[model samples]
Target: MSSPVTPSLTYRSPPGPLHATLLAGTVPLFLGALLSDIAYYNSYQIQWSNFASWLIAGGLLFCGLALVFALVNLVRAPKKAGRPLVYFLLLLVMFVLGLVNAFEHAKDGWAVMPAGLVLSVVVTLLACVTAWMGLNLRSGGPA
Candidate 1:
């Protein structure tokens, strides 16, 4: 009689869950930044609602924390961690650019006061998710 077929398992697991979580976090954080920017279009003050700014600020905080957490765990991980690290570096660049842009906004009399900041926060969120995905998948996999 032929032997029953058995599926083979590998040293690593699929990264679907981590991918989903990254997407989940990214959507909200990006949307929060976009929405906050849209709200600023309401009037000439170019100011944002305290609540909205706070939300974006929170997103930034969460993203920073997530990146740190991910990097710490990436020691045991494989090549997947490379992409996430790139994302984190990109995020830092975006943040620094945004800060510089803030000064430009002050001089240019732009209608949106925090336009640069909002975009920076969005990038941060995306980077965070990428980092999380890399860390969770590879870290938990076979070393």
Candidate 2:
């Protein structure tokens, strides 16, 4: 009987401590933003309030903080990592969407809310993908 052959695969560890922390931290913030939005819309009618304002502000602040972490890692790392770069870009896009959402709320434009919701979902998904990539990053250490 012929012995079965096994396929070999190389394992790669995640990024260093700082990068890993930043990436791990971002995922919860993204989920929080999504959940906050969902909770706000579900419980309240179509009207703005201090609570809604603060909820959004907090979410954006978290995203911004996470972005800073990613950006610092991108700049300080010996070699530029593509995942951090992509994470930075996604954060920027999410920030733009946040601006649009804020403007739409301020303008009392109910019609644009659907677009805002869709954008939020997209941003959340992208954030997840970015975090996943960050989690898979090979630690830039001596091999």
Candidate 3:
């Protein structure tokens, strides 16, 4: 009697070290910005807004590099149908919103409070979600 052969499974590779590092870096910078925004909202201190602006810039730099890597991976991936696509799109949204948040932070005085705070919250949440998904989800298929 012939024995049945087991099927081979192939799983999507995780992001490279640089990509992973960039993704990881976004969270803290954005979170710091959010915290700074909150402090500014409560304390009315101009310095807090300055801190938030700088943090948001740093987050943008890291996120933009990660976005480029995601795009390259999506293009190179054998099958472009699932998590990679979602990750790219989500990262794109996060970057755009982060840019908007940066613009909001550029405003002077009390004008930066409510809108800046709102944008910071949204961008920070997006950063967390993208970072989690980018690191954890693996797309699998036949070899």
Better of 1 and 3 by lDDT: 3
| Candidate that scores best on lDDT | 3
Q: Lowest-lDDT window of 10 residues in candidate 2?
A: 47-56
Candidate 1 overall lDDT versus native:
0.48
Model 1 quality (TM-score): 0.50
| RMSD of candidates 1 onward, in order | 6.1, 6.0, 2.4
lDDT for each residue of candidate 1 in 60-94, tens digit (9 for 90 to 100): 55545544555543443445544444544654554
Pairs with steric clashes in candidate 2: none
What do the candidate models score in CA lDDT, each in turn?
0.48, 0.57, 0.92
Clash count in backbone of candidate 2? 0
- Badly placed stretches (over 4 Å) of model 1 are 1-26, 45-49, 78-81, 87-143
The candidate, 1 or 2, that scores higher on TM-score is 2
TM-score: which is higher, 2 or 3?
3
Question: Model 3 — TM-score against the truth?
Answer: 0.92
In candidate 3, how many Å is residue 22 off?
Answer: 0.5
Residue-wise lDDT of candidate 2 within 1-143, one digit each (tens)?
99998755434544567656655565565465556556546655544323344444555665566667667767865656455566567767766665565554453434535555565566567667766765765434322
